[model samples]
Target: MAFEELGRFGVWRPFGGFGSEDARELEALGYGTLWLGSSPPGDLVAAEELLAATETITVASSIVNIWSEPAAKVAESFHRIEARFPGRFLLGIGAGHPEIAAAYKKPYDALVEYLDALDEAGVPAEARALAALGPRVLKLAERRSAGALPYLVPAAHTASAREILGDKALLATEHKVVLDADPARARATARPRVDFYLGLQNYTANLRKFGFTDEDLTKPGSDHFYDELVAHGDATAVVDHLAGHLRAGADHVALQVLDDDGQATLRALAPLLREVA
Candidate 1:
């Protein structure tokens, strides 16, 4: 199935912590998809377990790093998952940050080569999506693959991406949501998480394009930057903030709830799920 058909919202979780029971619960809660983050090489085994435990819901890797995992291995895993789950698996691939890679080469070139390898290995383009943030990578995703799955982006970026991708390509944007209503504490809790990505050039560049100044992109993002990027406050407020993405041309939104515990995060988000759906 095409990425656009995956519906309005999905759950984004780190692959390590969630078990089959958690997967089943999310499926029962009416999430159309489950996106696993920072998965290891050949880690689709865990994805298979989640897929096996749930029915109807689609499973995707928020990213399977291009550096560590070979295209052939990924292709094999894709085939295996597709054989069993069929239309329920969506492959989200990316050239992870240069700092993390052993070789530390040009990411765009590496991503193109990786996609070429996947193509040569007989992995159909429609079965995959890209984790792209910049204009060049977003265009590449439209041309070489199914669509783009951009993380931690605002609605303006989604609107810009839609213009670049035109009408047909899928545009799924990931948003981080915090359930806290207290402004100061919410921003405090979100600061560390936001700080990590603030130094990344892609994220910084995207923020610039979205009208944020260099000062706004500093160590801890400015209040203006944090509020735009991270959706915080009550369930209703969170839903209203997310709706901006849909209004801005996002085909789907993957939500990552920020909380000390994953179970508590899901529980807090339970009420907002139906609004997103």
Candidate 2:
């Protein structure tokens, strides 16, 4: 089955953290999708409520940890949400970081098993997506699911992923945007939030493949690293940065704003919503 066509750029934030009223407002603002970040087990049902409250906007789990939720449970949730919301729900599942899943042995293998179980439970391929960074996992996503949903990556990776998945599968990427124009402050605001991921081998290796040097991958991210990973400055500047992902072959881009205040961040991004739609 074909999922709803998401716009080039959508808003990325935590679902439970945002009020239903705020979600309605975002839907009314012409945003094509809402991507929820790192949710706990059984949160997909709550995600469905957010989608049900809005009209025409797709709501996706930026990633639901495969180790945290069993495929059977995920399938049940998917069925319920799909029956209720239909094409508006996209299951974005991933093998979470090794550190977090240290107790769960063989994560990659476990992810394969999870996907198998999801299939056994009758979740359709087009209704699901994988949070893949490497070529191996990207190929797996292509064969087994809808496509790859890569996070904290550059446009070059999107181009490569498109090649790996071919033209039919989705190539949705997550991008961080800072409304601040000041380079230092913007990087500072984005650093700690993304620092942990930079330390992860999956993210670092992806950055390295995209031509970021070992020096560029250092802690808090080098200037070059920050510049490429986090888009900063005015609304137009942020829009320009996101456009590169489309140019590089991404099917969809989810924009996560890093700002001091949530309300202000939404307000600052209002003008750019027109460009996104």
Q: Among these predicted structures, which one has the highest TM-score? A: 1
Candidate 1: regions farther than 4 A off: none
- Candidate that would win on lDDT: 1
Q: Write the per-residue lDDT of candidate 2 for residues 1-277, one digit (tens) a residue.
A: 3533576667788666657887888777666678888754554766887877888888888788887777888899889988888888889899878666765677678879988998899999888899999988999999999988999998889889999989888999999988888989889989988777867887887788889998888886788888898889877887888878988888788888777675566666767757654
Badly placed stretches (over 4 Å) of model 2 are 1-4
Local accuracy of candidate 1 as per-residue lDDT tens digits, 1-277 = 7664476878888887568888888777766788889754555887888889988889888899988888889999999999998899889999877556777588899899999988998888888999988889999999988899998788999999999988888888899888789978889988987688887877787778889898888888899887988888887788888878989988888888776765666666766767666
Instruction: Indicate the residue-level lDDT of 89 in model 2.
Output: 84
Model 1 TM-score, 2 decimals = 0.94
What TM-score does model 2 achieve against the real structure? 0.93
Error of 1 at 28 (Å): 1.1
